[model samples]
Target: MNRKATALDVAKRAGVSRSAVSLVLNGRGDGNVAKESQDRIRLAAQELNYSPNAIALSLRNQRSRIIGILSDEVVVSPFDGNIIGGADDVARSRGFVTVVMDTERDTARDASAIETLLDRQVDGLMYVTVGLKPFEVPQGMLRVPSILANCYDEHPEPQLHHVIPDEVKGGREATEHLLQLGHEDIALLAGAAESPAAPLRVQGYREAHVAAGFEAREDRIFMAGWDIDAGFHGAMKLLDDVSPANRPTAIMCANDRLAIGVALAAGRLGLSIPADLSVMGYDDETRIADTMVPALTTMALPLREIGRAAMTTLLDSIEGNTAEAETTVETMVPCRLVVRESTGPAPTR
Candidate 1:
């Protein structure tokens, strides 16, 4: 096989010095090296397929260039794994690496996992949760440049930056979508009260109603668990033994699993989707939402965006690029509305 290309080869090809190659590749070239030469070095490296030796570079900079990610069940669960994927994407692009440790929802193991990562000399840390909630920031996390994704610090005076989806806006937009489609009477299957995201979504649902000059009926909102069964049962209470005029024109669920349950209930009741009753879901889960019988219209969490934003913040702090590294700040990424066949104009009474 041909010998691997080196920085010297790249420098020669780009007509720059090897030291310039080192500076540019290590991200210290902005002011030290001319922009035009930086471009040439990068292009030459690409053409020659030359990459810097990560181990040697790390030793020289006294940084491991490795980001450690702690997750609450992301590795084992299908939901919210994209958050890590997004974080890794940014890390790789910036010449850094990511190492992840999953607690599998075991809060007791968090401290130990963090200690393990710290022992490994990771440059920074990031904590990601499967859902939006608050947790006490692990003490070890404060010892390094770190950030949170899809979760927040529970401390009275928060100590870390966090990136999360705008769940309240997601819920409001979902309800508004139904209302704009002429669904004046809507039922909400809010997720469990334990999840911080549940109540925020409910608040959004109510806000949309108030904005539309409609009263959000408390009786129609169920703090149902996040599952197919909860969705089915909640929907039955709304549609079963109720007259068409008395039934809600649309049912909004806190998650796609719940939406699946709603569909099952609708099928048993001989109600056709969108024609008789509209259905909406949140999270836009993989395989479930888009593959439902009529497909699903839902609000999508910005999982990847949250991850990317969180990683970017952590790296910025580690590299001394931001002064807010020591300050408490929150970043909220907006959720997207994905329209599908499950939602349409309300049926004429």
Candidate 2:
């Protein structure tokens, strides 16, 4: 194999001194080096495929240019891998690399994992979770600039910055979509209260009803678990043996799996979707949502966006690009609505 190109090769090709090549390639070329020389140096480096040595650069700049990521099963689980993909994209574009460690949702391993990342001399850190929830901030994270993605600090006075999706808005929008379709008697299969996202979404559901000039029926909201069985049971209790006139025209699930259960229940009851009842789901999961028989109409969690925002925030703090005093401790990304075959207008009474 041919030897790798170096700064010296780029300098000779660009007809500039080694110091000039270093200055231009390192982004300090503006006033010190002529614009023409900077352009030539970049073109020569590109042609020569010459890249800076990360180790040497780190030593000279006193920055590792590495971001450490602490994940609670995000790396191993298929559910939220896009968060890390998005974070890596931003990190790579900013001339930084990322190292990820998965704890598989084991909170007990958090401190050790964080300590390991810190030992690697990372310039910054990010903690990502598979879902939206609050956790006790790892004390090791406090030693460096850190951010949280799809999770937040549970402390009364939060220390680290967090980026999360606007779950309440997502819940409200799902309800509003059903309401706009002329469904007033909407049933909610909200996730269990243990997950922070559930209550916020439930709150949004109520907010939508209130804004639409109606009071939501408290009895209709079921704090179901986040699984197909919970959804099936919840729907059965709502629809089985219930008179058509009394049954809800639309059912909104906290997740797509629950929506699947609702659909299964509807099928068993010999009810045609949309024509007999409308269903909505959340999370817009990878293949599950789009490939469903009737394709789920759902609110999508902004997983990738949350990751990108968290990394950006962490990097800004590391590079002194953000004003610490003015920086907010939380960043909330908005969830998106994907319309599909699963939802429709309420049946005419």
Candidate 3:
């Protein structure tokens, strides 16, 4: 095996003292070492293919360059990975690494995982939730900097910086699309009824109905889990209620997974998409949206960006620079509409 070249070798080859070579190579020799000697050291290093050890550099700075991510849910949806992916991109670019853990959606376990990260002395922490329930943080452990993703703590006062999709806006936009296509009697296939996200999105749908002089009928809204099976069952219930001839022309599902179920249920009822009913979903998951019989029309969330923002903001807060006051720093990013074959003008003229 070839011996790795050291600073001493470079110095000897350059006809200079090892100390002089060290100073010049480290970029700390400015005005202290001769310019000619600096140039010689650089050339010697290049010829010897010398490279500094990154692990040693990190050790010197007392940094592992790793951040910790605490979560209560593993996969909320395809968007779940997206948010975390976005955060990873930002963190890696900044020379940081991330370690993620989940507590299976339990608040107590979520808090415990966070405490573990603190014990590990991570540079920063990101707390993520799949649903709307607030994952409690330790009131006493204020030293750990944490940013929230896809969930909020609902603190009566400002306690953490958070980044999540603007569900209300996404809900309104999906409903408005259906309404624009002349679907006034649209149904909302929502996630869990108690989800904070659910209520906000329902409000947006209400706003759209109100704008069109529609009553936003209570009977039209159905609550279901964020899964294809849930949507399928919920759609079946709606299918059982009315004859296909008189049923609502559109369904706005809470997320893509649910929308898939809706489509499957409609098929079982012998209904053709966009001909008998127009369907839309949120949190566009590629596997569900692109692979469906008719590609699903849905909304896109910047999940990855939310992840990155969580990492960065938490780091900032941990460093003692609190995020902008309680109101100004809204890390919530809005969702974008992704029109596809799944949605279209209502069956009605």
lDDT of 3 by residue, 211-291 (tens): 888899899888887888999998888876687666778888988889988999999988899788888988777677877
Q: What is the TM-score ranking, best to worst?
A: 1, 2, 3
Model 3 residue 70 lDDT? 70
Predicted candidate 2 versus true structure: per-residue lDDT over 189-286, tens digit per residue: 99987889999999999999999998999999999999999999999999999999999999999999999999999999998888899999999999
| Candidate 2: 10-residue stretch with minimal lDDT | 318-327
Q: Which lDDT values do the candidates have, in the order given? A: 0.93, 0.91, 0.76
How does each model score on TM-score?
0.92, 0.88, 0.77
Instruction: Indicate the residue-level lDDT of 74 in model 3.
Output: 46
Write down the RMSD of candidate 1 (Cα, Å): 2.3
Q: Could you tell me the lDDT of residue 20 within candidate 2?
A: 98
Superposition error at 25 for model 3 (Å) = 18
lDDT of candidate 3 at residue 72, scale 0 to 100:
67
Q: Kindly provide the TM-score of model 1 when superposed on the true structure, using C-alpha atoms.
A: 0.92
For model 2, state the Cα shift of residue 67 in Å: 1.2
